[model samples]
Target: MTEMLAHELRTARAPISAHLFVSGFTYTGMISSWLPDKPDAACTSEETVSHLVERLEHGDFYILCPDNEVTPEIDRKRVAWAAQDIIENRPALSRWHPDFAERFAAFEKPDRNVEKV
Candidate 1:
């Protein structure tokens, strides 16, 4: 989808107190529609923003709006902050199997001698 469409969807909310039921099973974050009361009802893209705002005001869900458009500067800062967080946390890197450092270290080591018959 285009960036404009995404921005519009993010900004639209209506019904002044409707709950948006994002499917927990969906990993792609694509919603078919926003229901006013029934969770299964399909809502148009235009109706989503207003519906969301309404729900948020009624304490149905917490709304977190972006302060500004995602510019290059903002993107760069986000990446920098994420890198800093990772460095500070120092979480285990074992998940990245066959690590480059580990491979390089093995390659640099001298080969061991084997017994001959």
Candidate 2:
């Protein structure tokens, strides 16, 4: 069996509260980078979305959406904020953000044990 399988995102609340949507990647630094580096640091997407929702519903989630009402302008801001937050939150993924290279190291430090010699 393959180690990975795909799952669709389902939310109990229709039109997932924008806060929740932003909270996932906002806190977790996308599905890829966040999980491996910080083994003890558990985030929602590291597990099934169902499991994530369970925790979130139980008050485990903490991102606040100051503006919950959706409007065209808000939608634009949401997308922009999420994008900026994603890049800023994870230094490893900062390359994705243009005009912000100085905010992150040019490249991750080489693994300690690797040697050119």
TM-score of 1: 0.23
Query: What tens digits encode model 2's per-residue C-alpha lDDT throughout 1-117?
Result: 111111121234344332243332222456446455634433444343554566567754333322223333433434444465565574333434565554322222233111210
Error of 2 at 81 (Å): 10
TM-score of each: 0.23, 0.23
Candidate 2 colliding pairs, count: 0
Candidate 2 residue spans exceeding 4 A from truth: 1-19, 23-46, 61-95, 106-117
Off by over 4 Å in 1: 1-29, 35-68, 90-117
Evaluated at residue 72, the lDDT of candidate 2 is 31
The lDDT per prediction is: 0.38, 0.38
Tens-digit lDDT track of model 1 for 2-103: 345444555785233333333222212254244234333333444545545665667653332222233333333333444543765633442233543453
